[model samples]
Target: MKKTFSREGVDLAYRDVGDGLPVIFQHGLGGDEAQVADVFPDRPQTRRLTLECRGQGVSGYGPVERLSIATFAHDIEALADDLGLGAAVVGGISMGAALALRLAVHRPSRVRALVLARPAWVSEAAPANMKPYAVVGDLLMRHSPEKARRLFDDSTIAAELARLAPDNLSSLQGFFNRPDPVLFGRLLVAIAGDGPGVSEAEIRTIAVPTLVIGHGQDLVHRLADAQVLAGLIPPARLCTITAKSQYRAAYRREFRACLSEFLETLA
Candidate 1:
């Protein structure tokens, strides 16, 4: 069932189901709770919780200006508090992964375990890989959605992404198709330029068990970023799965299996 909670003058939505090990698995940028359900293992013993970040899913965007990784992470922290959770497994995909990392580093007591899936950022701000998203955002801001889509398709960045990372290209192309391209454009610009804001030195200090999932064929969410995270966090287990672009079924299967194995270790 979907539940609502207020934070920072906005009514946010969350999903809490099942019963047992508490796991807060968040969705990626431009995704909702349904996205979390796609790759997360549906187990009777696991109570999965997903909080739709501000401006995404069914949640309200209190202030678009306040939209950042830090903001989203704090919202997640608030969700945990509202749920009366002292600690739980926290993880997410892409932008969601950055939020999870921030919680593990900044609020260690509330994150019993960490799961970084297809992480897009490691430490530095606005990695080069995220430039395509920024390009799309800029186009959306300058032109109408139809015109922006046409320009993005005709741009050199789209050409490069089409050849190298078709999946990433597809996601960027989807930006112009959103119901509120302008608002989503603002979000993309803000978050694409932002990182998890945690340095390698700080990441090395995390004592909780971590699972870092990575794959090939993804430019925005680089495998190298995941590798860097696995190397830094001391009890981190790295699992490489097939890229969703290569095979959707295999990608989700491997992702769920790796998460299950990691959760079993904690059990």
Candidate 2:
């Protein structure tokens, strides 16, 4: 069922499933709770929660500038407090992963386990990774979605992105389908300008049972970023999966098996 919460006076929505150990997951930027929540596996012993962060889902958009990783982290903190989900397992993907990481860092006592899926942040910032997203932002800001899509589709750069990083290209295409282009454009610019949640040194302090997942051939959530996380976080396990834009049966099995196995270990 979809439930509501008052976040800084703005209404936020979320999916609440099952009943047991609260496992809350956050979606990536531009993704609503439903759109990017297919990653979670159903478990009978756990209550699965996926929240639609501000400006992205069924939730209301307050200040466009307040839609950020840190802001989202506080949203999670508030939700956990309201639900009385103390020391719950926290997980997310891409931008969501950054939020999860920040929550674990800032509110260490409340996180029982950490699941970092497709972490996009390597250090304080990932400027090189921001270039294409910024371009998309600029194009969307200047023209309509149709015109921007045409320019992106016909460009030499898009062809290269299709060949090497289809997932990244797909992410750009997703922006076109957003409800409010102006809000989305403003969010794109704000997200591109934001820094990583915390530095490598900060993540080093987290000693929770952690699962780190990365994918191949995806530049937006680079494999290297996941590897660095696995290397730095003590006793952290890493799982590699196929990018959703390039999913195959083998990758699906691997992804599910890895997560199930890790969650089983936690129990």
Candidate 3:
């Protein structure tokens, strides 16, 4: 069922499912709880919780000015505390992965382990900003799904999306459909705001066991960043999946296998 909590006076929405060790799944930009539902269909012993970050999903957006990773981390902590969870395994995809890393760095005690999927941040190399591209992509989606498909299909980003499993592809398509130009533009600004990247020093200090999943052909999050992340974290294991026509189909088995193995270590 979905639940609500107040963090720093801002309302946050989350979903709690199954029953076992607590595992929090944070979605990337423009994502919500359904993304988690698609990726993880059966977790026999994991109490999975997917968070809808502020400005997305059912979560209410407070002052857009205060939207930052630090604040999001704070809200995550608050949610965990409210649920009486301590040191839960935390993970995310894309920008969500970046926030997951931030939690590991800033609130080390709150995260028992880490799972990052197609993480967006690398050490020093700046990925080509895809905000403008995504904007155009979103615009195209409004006018023509064919153009949207064509534009993204030809690009590396489309390949990444296509690589996902059929269900995941559908979920992603739903997410893309929900994009509001004004909301998306503001979210883009927030993501591109002050804290654009994480420091190598901070990453090295993370002591929690980490699982890094990367797709070799991912256009949004480069493989180089994943390599740097794997190299920096002492207790990190890196796994790369081959790029497929669809991200879900191409990496579904590999991602599940890797995540299952990593979760077993924590068990």
Candidate 4:
């Protein structure tokens, strides 16, 4: 079922599916609930709740200056509270993972477990100015779908893009066009901003068991970062999948298998 909850005067969209232990799925920047559905479809015993962060998908955006990791974390807390889910397993991909980590740090009681898929915030070399792409993407999103598709395809981590199928590629392009252009730009800024620092100090404080998923060929969020993250968190496990090349195959099978195993252990 899909619903909306007000947070700081903006309405955020979310979807809940299946039935079991609550599991919240936070999508990456410019991503919506569908991304989570595409990744995990058969976990019927796990009640999945996927949220569309502010300025993305059907969610309404607030002031552009307010877009940041901390604000997003608060939005997640509000969504969880509205759903009557006091504590749930929280996991995310890319920017979403960063938000999940922040949620665990700030609202410890609300997160039972964590799953990070190709987390993209730990790098120091990420571009500081996203204005160029944001302007281009916003224009393409409204006027040129083909150009937008090519832009996204080219921007994806080369090793990861090689793994995706044609259909998955199409789905990704569709997602890019679903959100508002202005809001998407703000989301881009939010993603590029510094994320939560889950260092040894912070990791040690995290009581929840965590799983870090990485691809051997992912350049954006290198395997080394995953190793560092796993090493820092006492109860964390690292799962690495070998990718033939970027877009080679979404590594769907490996991702699901690893996630299932990790969740099973949580049980």
lDDT of 3 at 227: 80
The sequence of per-residue lDDT tens digits that candidate 4 reaches over residues 198-252 is: 4447666777899998876544455677787777778889998754254435667
- Go through the candidates in order and give the C-alpha RMSD of each one to the true structure: 1.0, 1.7, 4.4, 4.4
lDDT of each: 0.90, 0.79, 0.70, 0.69
Among all windows of 10 consecutive residues in model 1, the one with the lowest summed lDDT is 174-183
TM-score, every prediction: 0.97, 0.93, 0.80, 0.79
Q: Would you list the clashing residue pairs of candidate 2?
A: none
Against the true structure, candidate 3 reaches a TM-score of 0.80
What's the alpha carbon RMSD for model 1?
Answer: 1.0
lDDT by residue (tens digit), candidate 1, 69-132:
9999988888888788878999999988999999998989989999999999898989998888
> How far does residue 261 in candidate 2 sit from its true spot (Å)?
1.2
lDDT of 4: 0.69
The prediction achieving the highest lDDT against the true structure is: 1
Ranking by lDDT: 1, 2, 3, 4
Compare candidates 1 and 3 on lDDT and give the better one.
1
Which parts of model 1 have CA positions greater than 4 angstroms off? none
Superior by lDDT: candidate 1 or candidate 4? 1
